[model samples]
Target: MRRLYGHDAVDIEVATDTQRSRVADVLLTHPITQRRVAFEVQYAQLSVAEWRDRHESYVQQGIIDVWLWGHTRIRRARSEYALEPYRLDDVQDELRKAGMRVTFINPESSQLAIAVNRFGRTYSLASEREVDLVAFELESIRLSDQGVRSDAIDPFVTAAREREAALRERELEAQEHAEARAAIEAARAKKASARDLERARAAREQFASMPARVDARSGVVRPSVTMPARVLCRQCGKPLDATLAEFGVHLGPCRWEQERLL
Candidate 1:
């Protein structure tokens, strides 16, 4: 502690109160802000209740409480068959649910490690990684109502936001493409309608200019009407069989030839 901070900035086994006092393992006072941070190193298995009691005690005195657990209390996840220390996952989860911090420090290497889930990511099993302790110490000056907050470097939230934005952009592009196709289809349908109308008008004129047909049985001249011609009946104002009408021998009443016009 003295090497990390200055000689006067660190204190050992500081008592919070005179009677029924709670002792801090190591107290570090910031030289500028004068904010106090108490670090408690626990190697033995400590229950959630006992840890909470000690943590709350420091908070009540306006001191930031930082807990560093050894392998017996919290260990890294491993897959190989080897003797490993039992880690208290349930205890850590309960504390985290109450917005308390859970961290680990290797007793031999003194390396600090934090859970990967705290960075807003997940895995099949719980995993952790060693963090830069100097950066964490500098950022620890920022406080919350609980006196201390998790200072893990977070990037997952930013990545998630970027992904959501990209999805929305793609959806918008798809909607625009559908609307463009519909517009093109509507224009094509209008052009086809106009062309059909023009063809119908041309068919009407073609029928009027056709030469008169001669009846074989009566040997009389008559206007010819067929499936490909368009001639209107003077009586019904519909298509008429001109040859039958001229001969006064109507085979059938006149009807419009819609297919020929188109």
Candidate 2:
């Protein structure tokens, strides 16, 4: 793996004391991007928590960590042997949570195998699929910005910058759309409030124009009504009573208008 990665301008077995005191089993550094990748070769039995802790520490230091399980052939069924670690499912679960894939290097064939799906426990052999190592290096380079040379920009850096710009533009556009929707909603609410106020004012005006009336037999006051007379009360054409100042210009009390105002 080191020899293959070397051709792609990646340095292996690099030492780092920032996260841990120990030397990494395999470290791949991109020359142009200065992206760092630490490959952990897990041969012995290690707990899932410990694995995650180490991986997280590397992540905090802005390093991409790849776990490489030792070549241990464990029988899953009668004839098939699962090429994974002791606690394959648990380790793979942790890897899946971190959005990473488990790697295995076949000692005999010197071939690389990657676990594509942890749930399905499926692996694809690199040699069989003709996976390009150079392409993989470029991908890793795009992940890290540490130690990147600013003197000259590579194709990968340009592409990464373009992707970031596009992502920012999309987020800005979404925010603008949300603000526009809120503004439209506010405008509609304002219009609705204005319409309600206009309706209420029109109802008050119509009620004020109506004339008061009274029952002849009971002598009780009745609701106002429209009438033809101009000088007298418009309701029943009745003359305004001087004693009933509360009735305004009408002959009877305007009880409904007073109740509505309250």
Candidate 3:
């Protein structure tokens, strides 16, 4: 298994000294990230307490440990099953707690088989079902050269960061476009205001030029009647300011004119 999957990335029978004691087993290490995996082989009978102690020691050191067992079986009902019992009082409880499972090596087929406990629901007097022992054949166990079981998560993280950057760039561009549009709108409003002021001034100038008239009964010149001023450009409908030197300039020559002659 080590030659086919682990290759040069992993070292066999590596000795690691922890706070409790030294552990010698198959040490799988990722070539790039240097993550470690420990495999422990147990052929002799061990108490449940002792197994838990050894498993917890490696776990405390942040190392993943896989327990391999040979010729270990737990009986359930009338048949003896190779898998660990589902009962809470059994040693299988300790194995499940340690996140480990017992694997059996078949000498005849030269293959690895894992014991699995399954439960079925049936319409009967018993609401709870019986435990069915099943053996699953492990066709292959391939580990990456990088020590990663499958693919690395770094690429997914990198892609997410790139997408976030692109979203921010789009937001910034939208903000710039909005600001430019607002500036254009402000310029238009200012120009329109200036044009209105010019038209009012032109109307006032026209009103001041009217001649005075006399009252027939008082025999006196009547006060000059003031009329509302109108100061529109003759060539165009646009308003103009009487104070400007080019107030009488044709619309075609005006700076504010939009159309041009060919």
Is candidate 2 or 3 superior in TM-score?
Answer: 2
Compute each candidate's TM-score over C-alphas.
Answer: 0.43, 0.44, 0.41
Residue-level lDDT tens digits of model 2 in 1-262:
3343456655456666654564677677766565777767777777788887887778777777767566572213232343332223456556645545445555555544443312223222221111111112212222244322222224434444555577799999999999999999999999999999999898777767654444433453534334421233433435555564345355335445545567
lDDT of 1 by residue, 1-262 (tens): 5554579988888775676478877777877777888788778766778877877787788888777666455544454442232234555655555544556666565455544332234211122222112123333333334444444423322343455577799999999999999999999999999999999888777877776543334343445446443344443444446565554333443323433344
- Where does candidate 3 have its weakest 10-residue lDDT segment? 121-130
TM value for model 1:
0.43
Ranked by TM-score from best down, the candidates are: 2, 1, 3
Question: In model 2, what lDDT does residue 231 have?
Answer: 34
**Per-residue lDDT of model 3, residues 1-262, tens digit only:** 4554458766667765644284646777656666667767655667888877877777777677765554344334442553334322244456744434434444446444343342232111111122233333334544443222212223332443455577799999999999999999999999999999998888666556643332223333423335333344544534455553245434356544535432
Clashes of 2: 2
Output the lDDT of residue 223, model 2: 45
The weakest ten consecutive residues by lDDT in model 1 span 123-132
**Models sorted by lDDT, best on top:** 1, 2, 3
* Residue runs of model 1 more than 4 Å from their true location after superposition: 75-88, 118-262
Report RMSD (Å) for each prediction in the order shown: 13.2, 12.1, 19.5
